[model samples]
Target: MTDPLGQQRPIDIKAQLQACRSKEDTFKTLVMLSKTQPRLTAEEKTEDNKIKGCESAVWLIIEEKDGLRHFKADSDAKLMRGVLVAILSLVKGKSLADIQQMDLKAELAELNLSSYLTSSRTNGVLAILDKITSH
Candidate 1:
C-alpha cells in the first residue's frame, strides 16, 4: 500500500502501520496475517508484563532470543487484541533502537485512531507502546 503523499516505499515500520485505520481494522489484518505466519501461544504472550495496566486485560510478552526480538500478546477485547497483534508484527523482531526510533505519533495519526479511541482505549495503546520500548 502506498501513502497519500505518493511515495513508493520499502516495508518500513511507518508504512506497515499506516496501512490500517481503526484499531479493529488493524486487528483483523493481523489475525489474517497470523494465519499464514505463526500463532502465538499463551505462554509466549507475557512480554514486558504490562498486562496489569491495560484496560482490557491485555498480556504481552517479548524476548530477545538469538538476535531477534519475539513477541506474543493477547487481550480480552477482540479489537484491542488485534491491535496488539499489529503492534507485535511491527516491532517484535526489531532492536531497541529501531523500536525507539519509530514515529509512533505520526503512525497513529496516519492510522487516524485518535477520533475513534476512548480515553481508556488510548491508555491501552500507550501500554502497548511502553511494552515495546521497554524491551
Candidate 2:
C-alpha cells in the first residue's frame, strides 16, 4: 500500500492514526480512508457476512486466493465503519498464521484509538479482530 504522498511501503494504520491531531480529526480521516474500500452492496451484506458483538451491524467477508486473504467489510454506523477499515487494513493480504500472531487490541492502544471508543465499542474492535484472526 502507498501513503498519501505515494511513498512505497506497507500500510501502517497505527502510524496513520497516530498522525491525526485529535479524535475528531482521526474519525474524519478514517471516513476518508474508508472510501478506499467502501461499504458493501445489499446482496453482499447478507447474514453470512454479519458480525457479532458489534453495537451496530457489521458484515465482513474474507476470500482466500493464492494463499493470501482478501477482506471486504462494512458497517451500519460510520464510526464502526472506521473501526472495520482500521482492523481490515491490518489483516489485508496476511496469511492465517500472520493474523494469529497479531495483537490488535494492543495495536489499537498504540494508535490511541481506545480513548475514542467506549467499552462496548472497544469490545467490538476485539470482536472484529477475533473474527479476522479466527478465519
Candidate 3:
C-alpha cells in the first residue's frame, strides 16, 4: 500500500524479517529498515509526541489522511528506531480499524525476535504498538 505521502511501502516486511536465519541477520535487517525511518524534526519532538513507558526517548507522529494513517517516528536509540520502523511497516497507511485489529505481539513473536528482547525492551516495543494502535 502507498503511504499518505505516496511512497511505495516496504516489500513484504514479514517475509523479509522471517527470512533472517540468525539474530545477526535480523539485526542487520532492522538496521537497514531503521535507515529508512523518517527523522522527527527537532520541532516535532514535543513531549506530546514522546512515547511514555519507554527506556529510550521515542517520538511518534501519526497523521490521518483520506481515511488512512501515516506514521513517522524516531528514537534516541538506534535499536529502538529499527523496532519502530518494523512496527510502522505493519500499520503505516492502514485504516484505524485495521491497525486496531492487529495482534502486534503475535507479529513480533512471528519475527522470532522475542528472545532477543529484554523485558524492558519488550515493554518499550509494546508502548510503541500501543501508541500506534491507540491513535
Candidate 4:
C-alpha cells in the first residue's frame, strides 16, 4: 500500500541525519527547515494544541487520515520549531503500524544529537514522540 506521499519505500530519516557533516550543519539545516515552516496563528497555538514538557511553549497537531498519521507543530523558540519539523518529517504520513514500530531512540542515537540537546530539550523531544505515537 502506498502512503499519501506515495513512497515506494520509507524515507530514510536516519541516513538524512547522518549525512550532516557536523552538529553545526545539523543546526543549519534545522534552521533552514524551520524558516520554511509556516508560523502558527493565534488560534492554532492555543491550549488545545499546546505540547507539554517542553521548556518553551510548543504546540502540536496530530491527525490520523486514511490509516496514516499527519503531524504539524510550532514552538516559540527558533530551535524547537526545527526540532518539531524534524520529528514530523520522520513520522508524518506513515501508517499507524509503521509509526508504532519506529525505533525513535535508535534514530536519534544515530543522529548523534545527545551532545547538543539539553535535558529539557531531550524531554521535549520524547514528549513529542509520545504524543505522536499515543492518542
Candidate 5:
C-alpha cells in the first residue's frame, strides 16, 4: 500500500488493532473501518459469495492485483460488518502466501478479541479464512 507521501509501505493491521486502549475502543475502530470498506454490489452478493457458516449474511469479494489480494467484504448485521473489516484488515493487499501463512485464531486470541465472539461467529471467521486460502 502507498502512504500519503506516495511511498510504498506495509499496513501494520495488527499494530493498528493493538493501538486500541480497550475492547470498546477496538470495536469502535473496527466499525469505523467497516464503513470505509468498498460495498459489494448486488451482482456480487450472490449465494456463491455468501459465507455459509455465518449467522449473518456476509459476502466477500476478492480480486487479485499484482499477486496481492484485495478484499471487499460486507454483512447484513452491523457488528458482523465490523468483524469482517477486522479480518479483512489482516489480509488486504497481501499475497496469497502471506494470507495462507496467517494464524487468524492465534492473532485474535493475542488481541483478546476472540473471547468476545460467539462460537458461531468464530466459525464464520474461520470459514472466511478457509475460503480465502482455498482460492
Candidate 6:
C-alpha cells in the first residue's frame, strides 16, 4: 500500500537517521522537532496508554484525523527519543491500512539500523510499532 504522506515511503528513514552524523545530533534533532511538532495533550497521554515493556519511558498517542493516522511519541532516553522521532516521521500521517502493511523490520534493516541497535533498542522499536498498530 502507498503511504498517505504523498508517494514517498520515507524509504530512507535509516539514511536520514544515519545522516545525523552523531547521536548527539540525532538527539538534538529529535528535541527540536518535537518542540515544533504537534503533540497530544496531557489528557491524551495517560500512564495506562503508554507503551509497556520498554527499558525507558515512552509515550505514544495516535489519532485518525481526515482519514490519516497521526502519531506523536516521546521517550526519556536520548537515543530512544531520537529513534522514536525517526520511526514517527516515517509512519505518521499514514492510513491505517498503510501503517498495517508497513514492513518496519525490513525498512530498518535496509537502513542498517539493526547492527547498531541492542536487543532492548530493538524491542523499543517493536514497542513503537505496537503503539502504532494499536491505534
Q: Which candidate number has the best TM-score?
A: 3
* Candidate 6 per-residue lDDT over residues 1-135, each given as its tens digit: 234543323545555556776656656655544453444567766896678878887788777999898776666665566566567767777898898898877766654354447887678678778778766
- Candidate that scores best on lDDT: 3
Cα lDDT computed for each candidate against the true fold = 0.61, 0.75, 0.80, 0.74, 0.74, 0.66
lDDT of 6: 0.66
Q: Least lDDT summed over 10 consecutive residues: which range in candidate 5?
A: 5-14
Over the stretch 1-135, how does candidate 3's per-residue lDDT look in tens digits? 545665436556677778999888888877876777778899999999998888889999999999999888999987778778777877877899998898878877776576557888877888888888887
Local accuracy of candidate 2 as per-residue lDDT tens digits, 73-92 = 88878777776767776777
Off by over 4 Å in 6: 1-13, 18-45
Predictions ranked by TM-score, top down? Answer: 3, 2, 4, 5, 6, 1
**TM-score of predicted structure 6:** 0.70
| Model 1, span 1-135: residue lDDT tens | 433543222254345556767667655554544343344466655544546556787777677877667676666566565455455656656788887999765566565445545788888788778777865
Which ten residues in a row are the worst by lDDT in model 2? Answer: 3-12
Candidate 3, which segments miss by more than 4 Å at Cα?
Answer: 1-11
Which of the two, 2 or 6, has more TM-score? Answer: 2
Query: Which of candidates 1 and 5 reaches a greater lDDT?
Result: 5
User: For model 3, how many clashes?
Assistant: 0
Native-to-model Cα distance after best TM-score fit, residue 102 in candidate 4, in Å: 1.0
| lDDT at position 90, candidate 6 | 73
The pairs that clash in candidate 6 are none
Better of 3 and 5 by lDDT: 3
In candidate 5, what are the lDDT values of residues 1-135, reduced to their tens digit?
545744223345455667888878778766765575567889989998899998889998889999999877889877778677667666778899988898866766655465457889888888998888779
TM-score of 2: 0.85
Counted clashes in each candidate structure: 6, 0, 0, 0, 0, 0
User: How many clashes (backbone atoms < 3 Å, residues ≥3 apart in a chain or on different chains) does model 5 have?
Assistant: 0
